[model samples]
Target: MTDSSAPPPAPAGPLSGLLVADFSRILAGPYATMLLADLGAEVVKVESPAGDDTRTWMPPVRDEVSTYYLGVNRNKRSVALDLKDAGDLAAARELARRADIMVENFKPGGLRRFGLDYESVSGSNPGIVYASISGFGSGGGASLPGYDLIVQAMSGLMSLTGEPDGPPYRAGISVFDVMTGLHAIIGVLAALHHRAETGRGQHVEVNLLSSALSGMVNHTSAFVAGGVVPMRMGNAHPSLFPYEPLPTADGDLIITAGNDGQFRALCEVLGVPELAGDPRFARTKDRTANREELRPLLVERLKQRPKMEWFHELVAAGVACGPINTVDEGVGFAEELGLDPVVTPGEGDRAVPSVRNPISLSLTPPSYRLPPPALGEHGAEIRAWLAEPTTD
Candidate 1:
């Protein structure tokens, strides 16, 4: 007979039936694992006795819980263990051996002493898709700490942010860490595909600095391929005229013209179609090079209308523009567009409002069965599960 009190099985998803041992903390590793958990992987988050560091990153809290911690950690179970303790170390190792995937963000050699490193874990769990996140590669930079702000500075991202005359500033969020996490996920998925065919697994490594350079895209390309180091131009694009926010009657509205057609369309909407054929602004390169001369002409027309009126008219006329929005306004805009950006996970009082995962799968979609857990919330149950003898 079935045990009526037993928990119901996890709802089906694309990654259903997969077990992921997540031994990572903070942004990058936790963010990747949380996404995997959302996709229906059975994620077991192994935390130290003190729990993930973000747990204490308070001030913006929900029910006195850290919203920062809550932001990236959902749909996973937590099991706290002190690797210094023999029993906890055994449990962690056992979980790794049984896991189909394992993720960690320890220093390059930090996990070696605990026997939780890829070499040791993969020896027993040959099919494990092991992912390691670091601030830098496991080269000379390995000795250096891997913080997102540090990466933003060292990777030249800060150099491209802020105004030309202002000091370099890090992005508002941990962008490189998030990018590294995404890169780690791509690596894990690819390695999993390879393992399915070959029945062997490999180590996947991602670092913040590398991900930052890659994420910077065109700016990095400008330097490497063109030997031109891109610099901060405030809200302006280095290669496009009328791409930055311009003054309106009441406020500012961002405008962009990536091609001749868009520039023509913009000029038409501004009731200055003659400017489209002006020798100083007819072509994209010419407009970019002569932006200073072209700016006053466009601004004169833009300043005649309120930003919202211009927003509707420009959008209707097939020109791209929008008002600068706060985060709440951004979410409201998505909601107004029927995007359904927010979701509440868990049940009853434990339910926490979170941003919905951005992916859309027609077949097996993401399922949120658990909220971000309290410290060691699943310790007993997970420990019992790991202690059981495996038939494999």
Candidate 2:
């Protein structure tokens, strides 16, 4: 919302001179470009004539704009183009031809018909780092549509998200989509570095299913390496005892004792120091194996105090524990720790509050140059820029 009529001056940061042509929509692609934009990339978000679908995902709105769209579309310019239209498609290809980077989450090979796939675009702009995201890989699973929920279910994440005896559940958020976006960013950065070294660029592909499997980490490893299929254990950790929430007088407090030392510390704080030396709970492996017996003993002491009191006391004793927090409380907790979790982009009237990027770089920190844009907010200017001859 920084008056789209006048482009904001570029900030001094990493990726300052990079031009990103964002042809992606929904969550994964847009989220990646937004982070690139934050890191000082000049991201031009190309949208269909009706705009990105998230623009209408409302009921959670700010100034009548969908917060869902705003959450991942800041610090970027917007251009509406109909890929089916000859004129607009030409303009889009022109944007791609001049971009240093390009990101899209269209179905596998979906952009081929429009001549915007990696092969076609890289043919014209050999240095362009093109990224493609999909639900699955481009080979056998090419035709399958990419959606986070489907990936969660297919990747076995949903099966491990609910209570042991209850039905499966998808995660509370599109975690795999976000993870894929982060992976896409990582791929683009690596490709850019390779381009700098070799004077050539390559296609970087990411899929939700693959990202999901990677994100599953230990759960996926349990099956492949240990021949053990992980199951839903509710709040429990499969390998570590005391790694989940325990009942307190008022509520549950998450406590994690990953090693024997932390377990000893936890026991000391709970006023059950003797439990740490007990044969059944003396070692990390022992505690994990005897968790059914150990859990009730720890819970007995935890229930003697309110969660917050226990939180302060246990944390002070070097035990990892805290009350489960809601989203708002999580932000407040970050604020209380002086992390400044939120940032507002744009100046006055149109400024929108957003979560700060998690990264912190001393030399070139992320910048918030613009708030999210209105549909086609910078179309005229972007089109004019695309019409100019490439300098590189």
Candidate 3:
């Protein structure tokens, strides 16, 4: 038997024997299942006949397929099942029965009528680790649709973003959705461990709003713990001075002097070492308190060199800094640092490029045995497996 404190090692990868019934759609649920699949779980993505909504999310397309869908659906098999149909409902229930874990993002109580909710499914599979993702909690915000932008606004992330005097702006990415998905992954993994120890699975619930609030970290703490509602500081950090992007002769550079030493080094690079000892800016806290008074002085010296030139100089001088990079340049920088940020999920010409799984397990690293599936690509096989006498 495996160690009681942890789930058994996967048959191939870290989670190889795990079977994930993914009855979720869009970003949050799909993203969570993809993480499990990367760890060697056999994830069957159960979708409506229309498929995932992201499959139709278009514009940035490759091979005529939605890159949005491709971005998170990798390493999983697709099995279309419409819950409204009796036969399909039976198939879905059977899939759930066989699943070691089940993930869903349906509205609160949405799956209860179909007998596919956690209560219903766990009736047959007592050891199933069931995870539910939602826009908000099931309590009062059940009806409110959970979208990243809405969460960003409601959870006060938008309030903390953008210019102090301008209207709040949404982040360039669906930050809350991704964060909630990651939280789901964490919950599922923990529940899996519990199941391994006691042979009893449990429900894991994560909401976008809650995740957003949690993701805000210091900002939220400022409001809740310190009785300070953090306002937008734009590119500047509210807690730290010299933490935002600074202009150079050619372009902008992101310079972060996080500590007194780094701040002193940054001053030295700007040929103003004496400024480090100045009473108004001698300490990190003092600098933050007097950043308005210090910004002009730093900007004047920063404009002497190009962004990249200053980046190298400051970095070498032990002050943390970098030039602002576009998405492609970011990837190139990762490559230059041997981070290997991208991976092709499978072999052959049809394999699509994807961001590599961030985890690095020495014993059982994540595998890329399969590319993302086409719509209903594994329907026949999955249905046949569900029809087996005892999938358990």
lDDT of 2 by residue, 1-392 (tens): 23444436655879898999999999999999999999989899999989999999997999999999999999999999999999999999999998999999898999999999999999999999999999999999999988899999999998899899999999999999999999999999999999999989999999999999999999999999999999999988999998998999999989999789998998888888899899999998899999999999998998998999998987898988888899999999999999999999887887899999888989999998889989998988888877877667
Steric collisions counted per model: 0, 1, 1
Q: lDDT tens string, model 3, 1-392?
A: 12132223334888988899999999999999998999999899999999999999998998999999999998888889989999999999988998999999999899999999999999999999999999999999999999899999999989888898999999999998999999999999999999889999999999999998889999889988999998998899988989999888998889898899999999988999989999999988899999999999999998988888888888899988888889999999999999899988655666899998999998888877567788998888888877779724
Query: TM-scores, in order shown?
Result: 0.97, 0.97, 0.96
lDDT of each: 0.91, 0.92, 0.90
| Candidate 1 local lDDT, 1-392, one digit each (tens) | 12233246555888888899999999999999999988989899999999999999988999999999999999888899999999999999999999999999999989999999999999998999999999988998888999999999999999999999999999999999999999999999999999989999999999998899899999999999999999999999988887999999999899999899999999999999999999989999999999989999999998998999999988998888999999999999999999999988877789899999888888877877778999998888899888889899
Sliding window of 10 residues with minimal summed lDDT for model 3: 1-10
Q: Poorest 10 consecutive residues of model 2 by lDDT?
A: 1-10
- The list of candidate 2 runs beyond 4 A from truth reads 1-10
lDDT of 3: 0.90
TM-score of 3: 0.96
